[model samples]
Target: MAKWRGPRAALAVAAGAGVIAGLTLRTAEYPGMLPAGTPDPELGLGLRLVCAAAVLIAATLAYLTFARRQDEPLAMTCLPGLVVTGVVLRHLVVTLPGAARISPAARIVPGAGAWVLLGSGVVMTAAGLAAAFAVRKTA
Candidate 1:
């Protein structure tokens, strides 16, 4: 197995953590009459399910990669996290532009979690690609 396997495994774990953190954190913050700003994930039912499903699949792939020292499973691990990131970004893209037009007091802003989720997805995908292209030496 190539030496990069160890770091790739770590990347899988980090990506899993990123998925959890992203769902737990706010997707967007809106200024309002409430003391604390309104957050998209404050209504957590749908997001909770999405987060759980992605993390579970990613964990399984990570285990398969570690146990077998196989790059294929590691590459597969990238899918779940990336899907979540895509969904989140799509929501933002489809919704955010007209959100602030509702009222002067109603302004939606991207939250820290959005950036973290995006970074995590990018890292996971890059690691997967590297694992896919790694060279195996002939005996």
Candidate 2:
């Protein structure tokens, strides 16, 4: 067994990031932060955190599997970057009041796509955190 110290650290960081991002996303809200009739965004922060963690875990597992095979370095780097970009975007959207001006649901209702974006951001943040931690541990 090729000691899983790297993966373990990655998982831990991913879990932490997920919790943080979920809470952040939930906080930057307007009336529950869901598209109405969407079950009040589930358990809000907790659910988002779990979703983020799962995404990170899945991506980390993929990296481990590919590294074992030794033929997907390109894919690994690109995938992680894409995930980071998404996370960053979500963070900006949530943190910036400017984004709120865009009317997430101008043609629909307020805070419509914001919920979806927040959810996606949660996933990406987890993946980015996992990759970042795994790489740091290895290096």
Candidate 3:
């Protein structure tokens, strides 16, 4: 049988997940004003920019994780995983009920975008951790 893959496959998964996450965010109808004081067109543009930046960052990090060697420190291998986890946790905190108490509009309703983001985050985190484990195993 062919040798099993490692970080490469995980990296691809992460990239795909990031793309989906970005698209979801781009098309999703976020409640309330985005910047609080911006005009509608500017706010829309800003949101698009933010979405693009997020996707770029995620994809870049995934690539970086894949590029690291198996001999690298485990902490280094796990850095991207940690970052991804942080992003997901941040989103959850901002969208959950506690946030609603702070700002009613922030409460996340179950929508395609929200669901996609949640799913993508789960996949990205899992794949990142798996990649780190594979690196450790092969080191």
Candidate 4:
């Protein structure tokens, strides 16, 4: 059996950390960060779905990395990138003129959840890239 070492191990750790961070963001609410009104239901649902997808991807990455499976590192790299894209899209949706007109509360600044998601994505991406590089060097 191949031992977990180097970049593969690091990727697994990073993925696990992302999963934890995403879960924390889901449960915790930041008061006063959002305006004193209900947020756009569709936008909110989209954000939640994106977060859920990220968490799932991270979990899968963690498993594959821990197992030392190197079959699809490149494809794995895209998972974190997708998470980052989702976060960016969420920001755009909140800040767009149409969003502001739909709900004045849309002007509210992003809360801890946004920051956590961004950070998690960054870490996951970095770790995935490092693992991919290691895989290339070995192959």
Candidate 5:
């Protein structure tokens, strides 16, 4: 747990905070954030912001509580936070006003950058959990 408790925990907190900041700066439903020609979906920016905030808070709490517990599972405590942070930050960034200006291809790409970020976040989270699980098993 030492590995997760120290650097990993700090990283998790940073990621969560980043996501929250990103979302506050750029709401998900804003135009020019999604890929070009993407139909205007009826999603609410307020809802996405709320959800992102929830994820950040949950992650922080998990780190402070479960992650700090002596016998707790590192994966169990940190996986959700890492995954949520990655996904949320990705969404916020992809949907930011300037994202489209940087890469128009992102809009044409099937599923767009936000989707890619979400998928990547899931994979990273799974990998982190697996690594933690393996360590526990070995010990």
Candidate 6:
């Protein structure tokens, strides 16, 4: 068993998770958008973070997989990044436009898609947290 395999696998998984998270944001049901109809519900900070994380993770994984293990401390660093990214993503999703942005008459109710987003985000965050903790424990 090679030492690099662990980090390589983790990065690939994180990239896949990132892709799923980005897809969930695509569905309708804008939860916290001010004005209730923010044209593009798909554009959010969480999505950006996950997408960025995914790309960065994948790139890091690719480099690690091919470039040879340069350092002992670099394995699974993306998991911690995933943990932070997932938390930020969920946070942005839960409080999208912020309370002050919405008018008193406007009430945002989550649709089925919104529920899906929330649920997926929670699961993603939980998984990231668990992975991060596990990585720490092992180290």
Residues 1-139, model 2: lDDT tens digits: 1254345335434544543454454334454343443323223454444445555654565566556642222124334334444544544444334444444542222243345444444444444454555555556
Model 6 / residue 114 / CA error / Å: 8.6
Candidate 5: pairs in clash: 35-107
Q: Global lDDT of each model? A: 0.67, 0.43, 0.46, 0.54, 0.47, 0.46
- Candidate 4 — worst ten consecutive residues by lDDT sum? 26-35
What would the per-residue lDDT of candidate 6 be over residues 61-125, giving only the tens digit for each residue?
Answer: 54554466332223344454455455445544554444324543344333343444344444434
> lDDT tens string, model 4, 1-139?
1343345546545654664565455322323454445443233556666666765665666666556566354337546556764664556454444445655644544445556656666666666666566666677
lDDT for model 3 comes to 0.46
Per-candidate RMSD vs. true structure? 3.8, 9.2, 6.1, 4.8, 7.5, 6.2
**Clash count, candidate 6:** 0
What order do you get sorting by TM-score, best first? 1, 4, 3, 5, 6, 2
lDDT of 2 at 61: 51
Q: Name the candidate that leads on lDDT.
A: 1
User: Against the hidden reference, what TM-scores do the models get?
Assistant: 0.79, 0.31, 0.48, 0.60, 0.45, 0.42
Q: lDDT of model 2 at residue 83?
A: 46
Per-residue lDDT for 41-63 in model 3, tens only? 21134433544555555566555
Model 4 off-target regions past 4 Å?
1-16, 19-43, 69-75, 92-107
Q: Candidate 2: RMSD over Cα atoms?
A: 9.2
Alpha carbon deviation, residue 85, candidate 2 (Å): 3.3
- By TM-score, is 5 or 6 better? 5
The residue pairs found clashing in candidate 3 are none
**Which lDDT tens digits does candidate 1 get at residues 65-116?**
8798777777776677677667667656754544544443666777777777
For residue 54, give model 2's deviation from the true position in Å: 10
